[model samples]
Target chain A: MQKSLLIDPGKCTGCLQCELACSYDNEGVFNPAKSRIKVFNFHDQGRFVPYTCTQCDEAWCLHACPVEAITVDRASGAKVVADDICVGCKVCTIACPFGTVNYNQSTGKVMKCDLCGGDPECAKACPTGAITYVDADWTGLERMRTWAAKTDAGQRATA
Target chain B: MKYVIAGAGPAGVIAAETLRKADPEGSVLMIGDEPEPPYARMAIPYLLAGDIGEKGTYLRKSKNHYKDLRIDYLQDRVKKVSAKQREIVLDGGGRRAFDALLIATGATPIKPRVPGLDLPGVHHCWTLADARAIAKRAKKGADVVLMGAGFIGCIILESLLSRGVTLTVVEMAERMVPRMMNDKAAAMLKRWCAAKGVAVKTGTKVTKIEKSGRGLTVHLDRGKPVAASLVVVAAGVKSNVGFLDGSGVKVKQGVVVDDRLQSSAPGIFAAGDVAEGPDFSGGWSVHAIQPTAADHGRIAALNMAGHPARYKGSLAMNVLDTAGLISASFGRWDGVKGGDFAEAADKAAYRYIRLAFDGDRLIGALALGLTDHVGVIRGLIQTGVALGDWKQKLMSDPHRVMDAYLARAYA
Candidate 1:
């Protein structure tokens, strides 16, 4: 079954462990600054939203790459940067609507989350279950069940 | 041919790549002082934001990026250059010869001569080592006092805030980013940051930093002393032009270069922050932005490769995302002498646009919370396109820039 990282921003504690884990897994270093998955803190609102490349089927970064540096991972459905091929032009960083495909100045290549070769370190590192790897088809199963339960209560009250 | 590039910053790296591309048989030696793998200083802010790791800051990712290209990368400081002999002496008593030399030494963060600056808690967020040190002490709920609210300082505020530190920003200027922005635009930015719970002290200076008990105390020019665990000095930067002294390379605020980026010495070129080349406004100024540096690298490499490439003066442009507010400035953002100005501000939407005009040409612009017209503004200014009748319309309604641009260019 295909897997997806389902994120619940409400459950995030802003600890940045997911970022550190993702960076470490991909880069072999404990640097959250280089992490593909980023946690944006809305401090005034007291909200933390961890964002990353959503691995769109028709990725903007893939198409925007002039040298075809960005590619799709067939197995994980992730968009990855072929650093060797990237010319460091930064067109993909502009093409990405979500601002997920960002340019790495050090490497002169654009980078996004590749889901850590399908295991997805961000989901595993989340302490509060804010991020979870689940079956892509059944990601909304819990939400549907909640609405169904609400409908049943409404019908019971009407009866 | 032996090509030596003194400085492995972005421009230097690009120069090496370009040189290698054009002259496949030539030997390229890229030298930098920093011991770490060639990295972008701009990425440090992202590092502070916990966006990527140290490896993410590297200019080339794949193993053997430079090695595969056959470019020699060295991490040795240059003490001086014998420009007359086309030789560079390393600090460790070594000499390297060059047929073509490009100086992309970049800049160094200025450590202001302030009392108690040598203390343990005070740090300059410039290098990888500095980032690690800052990450250690700038813990969640830690009191952090950041000196200087300029472009560099303000850029890192978001990252520091993300790290969950209690931030207090002190700026010597009346407003933030004084070099790039006007009072109104800077004021708007400061208000936006303050509204988001950031403590902004404008036109303020840090008199001294003293150790108070186990923590530290930051004395300000005005108001009460700020208690802090971490004090980040984000004051300013100066060009890396020291190695060229007595080399007859010529120096102003930076190494002086011509339109070809060629210095006084034959076969010597300067690029990036170290080179004070021509500015768009008829004078020489160092545009330290990344895009300009990339252009410099390309042009310098082309010239070195025996291709004639003339650099038409660099333009000053900066786009900043402070907290949630996005702001940008381009060209002579502060209107020139006797230049007409058109401005529009929407306090409710937090949208603003100010257009600078010299005669009929679009000279410069300031924008806040408006990203759609950025490209058009840049294009019109760079081209020096005459607005004609559309100029009057823009003067009345700056939001009609798209329409004016369409009418002028296409219509």
Candidate 2:
């Protein structure tokens, strides 16, 4: 089964645990600036939304890469960027519609979510289950079940 | 039934120790997101002031103490928790199934979305990293523009003033600590700030912030741009509840916990800044303080171990030391509309005291400066003692009246 990442904004208190986990795994530092997952806080509305690259199938960054450095990992279905092969050209950062791909000044390379080789750290680190790894095919199953449970089965039975 | 607690903050560490005493056989596995052990949140301002070092803020017993208690401490964050499986997923792709779980994640400072907030020298005072950033940016003679004149901002002012750093306090409210103090008490504090050479711009709003040649320029609503080398935005903090989304836990402002600190989810409890429990003083309010957080940890641990306990609420008390001026307030200061008020002021000494009463019962009291009678007033507010015949004497000489109350309570 293809695993997908699920995010619930309501349970998010903007703790940045996922950010810390992501940065620690990738960069060996607990820096939010370098995290693959970012928690954005809408202060007035009192909401925190953790956003990341959705790992698009028809990736824009893949097509935009002039050096053919971006490749697809079959095992995880993640768009993995080869740092050694790729030149520090920022075209992929601009080409992405969601702007998830970012240029790292320190490494002189572009970085995006690689799903941590199928076991995403952000999903694992999220204490509130704001971020979760579930079956990709059943991403909308939970919401569907909720709406299905609310159906007027009794009324239909009476009719 | 060993327990694993994530986050070695005030709530986490306190629960670990409390649990050790309650259940000797139950070993504790503590994971700290930060490298440092538990430290007092109130002492961070003192550390910034150079009155204390980073070591001075440490609140844990000692390195040997954790070993003695048989706790396996790991300085790492918990990656995930499976409530059904009762297992905690670690960041290193490891899992530890537990009998119970406690999440005392605490809070993080709210960084405003204003432009140039991420620029160099723009800092916050929530964490050790933030404090270090501010300290690194601060110079001996640099001007510091502090946004928000709340409790944290004012405490930072006290810290910065000791270092001889020029300060410009920008507050949106007309008075400082509007929620904590009355108008009269705020006025006294304002005067004290002025006397100490701190430029307080109350009712001032910062609309724009920009980098201006090795410093930041704060453009306010009412005045010209104030240039400063460092900007410490002590706006406030929100509970670190973001990770609990989709976890089947109820969250509102904070993690919705019962009097036992248990969330809607079974076996998962939240405490400290992240958990909002019952506030007994008011109508089901949430108390956010170090003592309350500690209390929540104790109560939660007992219940987590199948030993029932209930949290009896917390006092909303705050003592602030700003540029050597001491201000402490407790309980509700705003009396019912048109309630009787007894006030006395000594402008020369920068001292003022006001007792708001709703007929014989004392509702709130505000005392500023070196008011030696504060101890007595605080006791009256805490114990809910009737003024009785001393009501008339309180209007004339509050010190004598407070003494009588103290004498009565002691008797």
Candidate 3:
């Protein structure tokens, strides 16, 4: 069963716990600038969306890494950046369409979600369950259920 | 059950401690993204002003106190979570299965996408790193340009001014702390800032921030370029919910949770700055203060542990320290439209009080400098005391308001 994150934007209060968890997991500091997962706040719309590297089956960040620093973790299916191998060229950061991968000035290394080997701290720290770890293959199950519930099935004729 | 808490901010650490207290036999694990344990983000301004030292800002429960509680304090962040498998993946390819999970990820400072915002001397005051950066450049005679005159900006200005740093505040709004203070209170604060030699420019926008030699030049909308050795951007913060893209947890402005702080998913919960819970005073409002965040952590942890606790909403009380002056505001100040507006001001004493109302019910108030009757006004607001004959006594002696209310409530 592949594990995947389920995000509910309505539950997100723009808290950076996930970022802090990501940063502390990777950078050893509570620096959001260094976190792989970044929360975007649309103030006018009153929305908080946590965006990160989705670990796409065919990852752009991995292909863009000239040094081959980005690699997929077999066990967790996470695309991770190997800091020692990374050249800090920032080519991959631009290559990614989603802008999930970023360059950290202090470390001069590119950073993105590594999925914490599979047990995501952001999911653990989330008080509202806005972020959840679930079966990766069934990520759309919740949405499917919602739409299924909305399906207008007229009441069956009385038995 | 071994509990793993992520993020060492107030929400994370408080949850860890609460878990220890609730289930003494349960093992606790705290993972901090920052090198330092949770320090008071609220006290950073005092540290910048030299009133408090680096040690004073520490909000930790003593060194290795988690060890005493038999809590495994992991410095690493959890990279992945497998809810079906009941395990968490660590950064270095490690996994830890947990009986329950609590996410207390706090909010991060919003760094706008303005050009040159990432340049040196540009900083935000949400973390120790930001504080240290600003403090390093805030020399004895350095000129500092602060963007955003909200709570953080005003507090940082007060701290910087004490160190003899020339300060200029640039706010896009018409008044300072406009969200928290009404027009009347804002006017009083503006005058106070002016009297203290702080240059406050409201309704002004920062067009560009460019590097000039060792210093930086901040170009304003209708003024000559203001050069500063340092610049602090206290614009505001947004929830740190960016990692939930593929995660099936529902989110809006914040991680939307019901009164129980439970999200759409099972075995997962969010609190602190990340989770938006029910607001009793208003309809489903999210509060981003430290006290409220602490409350969220406690309530969420209990529910996660099967105690079935519901979070009662928190009051949005913003107490500010502007130089030596203290300003505290609570509830809705705008509710008081037009019943009576009364004030007592002394420029020399720096003392001021302005009260507004709608007939009998107390609506809004501003207390500045030093007033002996602040407690009375605060109590009246808290208890929802109708003015009755109290309005007449308030005009002559405001302290009588509290005395009368206390007499009635206790009577």
lDDT of 2 by residue, A1-159 (tens): 777787777788899999999999998999998987877665556767676766755364664443346788998888988876444444455344344676665775678889999999999899998899988875554532332222111101111
| Residue B83 miss distance in model 3 (angstroms) | 5.2
Candidate 3 C-alpha lDDT tens digits along B1-411: 867776777677667777787788887877766776566676677678775566656655257777877778777776765656767777767788778777667788888666788888898887888888888898888999989988778777878897888889999899998877766567778888888888899999888999999889999888888999888888888887675655566778677887667776676777777887776346665677665666677766777666777655554555555765656555555554456765676665656666656676555566565422233343455445566776776666543443444333321
User: Which lDDT tens digits does candidate 2 get at residues B62-178?
Assistant: 557788888788877777667778887777677887887888888878877777788788888877777888788776888998998887888788878877888889888999988
Q: Rate the local accuracy (lDDT) of all candidates.
A: 0.78, 0.71, 0.68
Q: Candidates' interface RMSDs, in order?
A: 22.4, 28.6, 24.9
Candidate 3: TM-score of chain A is: 0.84
Tell me the tens digit of each residue's lDDT in model 1 across B119-235. Answer: 998999888899999999989999999998888888878789989999999999899989878888888888888898899999898999999998899999899999999999999
- Ranking according to TM-score, highest score first: 1, 2, 3
TM-score of each: 0.74, 0.68, 0.66
Top DockQ prediction, candidate number: 1
Stretches off by above 4 angstroms in model 3 are A1-159, B78-95, B336-365, B370-401
Index of the highest-TM-score prediction: 1
Chain A TM-score, cand. 2:
0.86
Please give the DockQ score of every candidate, comma-separated.
0.02, 0.01, 0.01
* Chain B TM-score by candidate, in order shown: 0.98, 0.92, 0.89
